[model samples]
Target: MSIAPNQCTVFVQVWVDVNALAQGSTRGCYAVSNRSQQSSGEGSANLHTNVITSSNVCWTVLPIDPQYTGDFSITNVGAESGWEQPPAPVAGMPNVFTGKLTQSTVGGSVNSNIQFSFDGDNQITVTLPVTITPVTQ
Candidate 1:
């Protein structure tokens, strides 16, 4: 699917504890924030988007700690008719993801999760919950 040049982009900053993650401890190893700066709270943030028919939106995942190098995979937890199937990570740009608002009769929302896995000695996966709301316009 081709995305518009001016498509709205949502940025999700991933905070990770490299040491803890490497040690296979996911307790407080992962957190997601919409802001570029780190927050005291640990967990994912709700991301809202306003869209028109065929509107394209992109999600970019940025790991706070550059030391933690791993690919991110996004999964839709529930089906939302207002949005087309979410796109996979852009090839060569593993951190970038895209989704398009559908022309459904009704606007809907969906809960999605992104998993960041480390291919290091200890394979650990951290899932960040995200809420996607498509507002029909």
Candidate 2:
């Protein structure tokens, strides 16, 4: 698999379908002005459903409290990593390298940074960036 010079689109769909507490005929929907970690309200009631980060996307979301020492085993080799699949549909394939992403929450502010690089790139630095998304629930 090969990543071109530009292509890192991380689309996180928060809570656009959830209906919040109704005041009248107007049903509540996710508004662009809402920004809060505890926005997942209705999900806790129906379907016992909770937001689970879709790991299929390239990033992982860390909480806004405490801190984290990012660590995970690599799940693929460079050739068949992201979009490319291994020649054989074998299980337990590993990533080329491992990394640590650090995040800390202070004064109600969330700060996080995750870094990953392609060791093969000699001329330039290759990396995958992490994105945080807030949604209504």
Best by TM-score: 1
Residue range with the least summed lDDT across 10 consecutive positions in model 1:
33-42
Candidate 2 on 17-130: residue-level lDDT in tens? Answer: 111221221122222112223332322211111122221222221112233222222233223222221212112322222211112122121111122222221211212222
| True lDDT of residue 6, candidate 1 | 43
User: Per-residue error at 74 for model 1, in Å?
Assistant: 5.4
Count backbone clashes in candidate 2: 5
Clashing pairs in 1: none
What overall lDDT goes with each candidate model?
Answer: 0.50, 0.22
Model 1, 58: alpha-carbon shift in Å?
2.8
Clashes of 1: 0
Candidate 1 residue spans exceeding 4 A from truth: 1-6, 27-55, 67-81, 103-107
Model 2: which residue pairs collide? 1-79, 74-95, 75-95, 76-94, 76-95
Across 22-85, the per-residue lDDT of candidate 1 in tens digits comes to 7766554444434323223435343333334465556555455676656544332223455675
TM-scores for every candidate against the unseen true structure? 0.59, 0.20
All-Cα superposition RMSD per candidate:
5.1, 18.7
